[model samples]
Target chain A: MARWEPDAQARLQNAALELVARQGFERTTAAEIAEAVGLNRRTFFRHFPDKRDVFFAGQDQIEADLVAGVTGAPPGESPMGLVGLALARAADTFAHLPREQARARQAIIDAEPALLERERQKFAVLARSVGDAMRERGVADLEATLAAESGVLVFKTAFTQWLADGESRSLPLIIAETMAALRALYVTR
Target chain B: MARWEPDAQARLQNAALELVARQGFERTTAAEIAEAVGLNRRTFFRHFPDKRDVFFAGQDQIEADLVAGVTGAPPGESPMGLVGLALARAADTFAHLPREQARARQAIIDAEPALLERERQKFAVLARSVGDAMRERGVADLEATLAAESGVLVFKTAFTQWLADGESRSLPLIIAETMAALRALYVTR
Candidate 1:
């Protein structure tokens, strides 16, 4: 019942992640990835402009879900509270991925400087999306931006913790802990 | 006595900023920057790797100062306090530059995507430097990194506010305010 061919894209992405994890993003070529998936290079390019593209393809969907989550928070929550809710939702979305798969993905990204830069850019884009969503609900500009950036910070902190060794904690719990840490900074000030 | 040949590097950097501000980072060439500095292109290349290098010449010095500040904080001060002190000091170091020159430098960077990427890389380097300094001080790794990253966030937020229209506040005050906001995030949680 899906509108698009989800399995095909998933296969290509998983193959790219696997090859990149083994050989490194810089060393892994699109041709090898396509061949691994039993698809031609042209079909690979149809799904992604490059290997980096595969890493970023999920971002649009993530942003849409984030916006919806922020906008639909319970009736009386503060702006910051709404942002917290959105981040919790995002953490939950990623929670079902196997730990080994997530670790491999993070390792692939950490090994590539270009991929890290692109990740930063993607975070910036997500921040702007959060800002736009907050503004739509009548929050002003600078505060919206500040809240969005703060949300991304919290999300990054939790994600990093979740990806680390001995981290049996859930992403949502880590996110709540990070929010507490950020709040502690305010209190100490 | 000053340690190095100051005028040559300063003149070259100023010329590059001026040209990039008047024209654009992409449109301005190394030859043009050299000519503006009253030097030949070869002399320009002697001091900087390329045109982009001119914008980031003193980051090493700033990072050194930040590490020193972090390592020397009094016992019992949170890592965040030490980092805030370093950021405030760095902002003050730039305070002597004419406001127009500061704006011009930022304007050139704002106009170039490549320059912005370089700036982000520089910040990441600075963050790692601070984190490493904290690690050397016996702070645990993840906490050290979080504190270091939080410092960079405060610096960035303060810098953006300092550059905003009608913002007559001092850099330290702005940084302190940002720290306060960051702390508030944790408190209200």
Candidate 2:
């Protein structure tokens, strides 16, 4: 086997998801996933600590993007404005992923309570990180937490809509629309 | 021992928390917890399915209270208004719990990742139930979800405040103040 495999991480993630979706998460093995991608089990273990980690492959990158979005916002923007920019940026990460692949991933997560728990934990961490970023930019503590959580709520709502059957809008567009709807809720009456 | 012991559930819960806080959640056993409160392992199992459940003893009642608060709102209340009422009612449940006990429970939850994951899952369930109750009250689908999520965020924020060392406000007051802060985020400028 070649010592250097290009895009090995991506290949392993794709293979893991495909195998898990077909055979179920518990039934799938790391070795089988590696073999399907023409890599050894060692290579799979090197890329991911466990099979479940493969299911959440790009979460760190997504979190970094969100934090950068908040930190880089123009001075004088409201806390919610910073959150809006951050979530829109994070939505772009989803834009690069194939909707069918994302849907399949969601299906696997939905079927497994353990995976769903991990997903919830991931969002909790994301909210905390985004809130910290907002605080670094001088937003008040309570406001930062509220904005970060609200941003996550918008992302979740828009992600669901983006994955809906026959929906044609881009993820970023859906995120923007969701943010607008959230604002509308508070402003009306 | 008598098969029916009065307040066995609450006794077991208090004993479990004390044991777990002293010995750590991983080191504590259901039998040990039951023994601390003058009960047997069999009696503990009857009250809770697992030892971890003791920390979350009254969650079902809390969920029911939140849902009822949403469903029982006066006619023509807005979605956010309904959420505000629901969370404030949920706050009352926390008010009945002694501050030190709630603080200890939170410490244990914060120390254990498994417990924290379960807590997040509980909140997720609470949010969904709150949203469903809003839907039954004629709120639109997206608005209902958004409002429910926002309510949970307010609850979490107020909860942390209520637990803070120097803060003495009631949970319901903190929840209402948090809801007002959430609204202020959108209404200002």
Candidate 3:
């Protein structure tokens, strides 16, 4: 009898990120990743096109959720307010994944130049998509663009810290804190 | 008699970026870049260890100018306000570069993934140094990090639009406008 785990994709992703973190990303092989998780090479390929995709598996859903958060925010908030609320929702969604898993993914990304580039490209894509989503919310051009870029940067900074060792704050809370610190800029002006 | 152009470094940088833009960045070699500028390989190596460094020619000066802008700001300004002013000054310093040259530099950076990563790394370095400079100015930990990161994102977004074809706004003007839009988040709160 075959004992199948329902979360095959996640298990593979965790194994791959861990393997890449333990060894240099360049030295890790697909077969090795599959072997680490007791999955066949074919099954691994079915889940991920390549090793890098393992780390960014939920990318599309993340963008969609982020966009939905922006476009579907409660009315009457300022553009940046709506964007901040949107980012908070986005952080909550990410909070589901274990912090250690995120850190494992980040460790590989931080160590490899090529993976770092891929992460940069993902952020660039996120900014463009988030900007467009805000535009769909009827926000002005420059306003939407600025808020989108700021939200992504805040998310980036907070997410990095949220996964730090001994850290226990929720992603949304960290993001709110970061945004509040930023807002202090205008009050003191 | 050889005619000497004093700005060989600038000429080399221009040649390298253009070459990378025209040909794919990976296909362009250092020898080709030197040949394009009529310099010997040894001369090229003297200026930059490799091809990637050419796109980041102003690395040291940009960091110094940005840090100086933060450290030397007139007292009685909010940390974020000081950062905005410092970013404005940094924008001014960059504005001295010809628009056409900056556009050419950006074109290759935009087109190549590897160059984009190198650019990202440069910005990360800029943010860290800017944060340290703010720390030295007596700003709080989270506040300094957020401001520095925000300053870089603002710079990135403005610099991108500043060099767009048919656009003629000064870098500082674009930066100022971007900051104003961001500051509205606090003002309207």
By DockQ, the best candidate is: 2
Q: Which one wins on lDDT?
A: 2
DockQ-based class of model 1: acceptable
TM-score of chain B of 1: 0.90
Per-model TM-score versus the true fold: 0.88, 0.97, 0.89
Comparing candidate 2 with candidate 3, which one achieves the higher TM-score?
2
For residues B50-167, could you state the per-residue lDDT of candidate 1 as single tens digits? 6788988878767877787887787766767777777766776766646667677888888788888888888889989998988887767666777788787777778788888788
lDDT values for all models: 0.78, 0.87, 0.81
Binned by DockQ into CAPRI classes (incorrect, acceptable, medium, high), candidate 3 is medium
lDDT of 1 by residue, A105-174 (tens): 7888888888888878888789889989888878666557777887887787788888899999987788
lDDT of 1 at B31: 86
In candidate 2 chain B, where is summed lDDT lowest over 10 consecutive residues? B88-97
Model 2 complex DockQ against the native: 0.78
**Where in model 2 is the C-alpha error above 4 Å?**
none
lDDT of 2 by residue, B112-133 (tens): 9989988898889989999999
Superposed Cα deviation of residue A18, candidate 3 (Å): 3.3
TM-score of chain A of each: 0.91, 0.94, 0.87
Query: Can you list each candidate's DockQ?
Result: 0.40, 0.78, 0.58
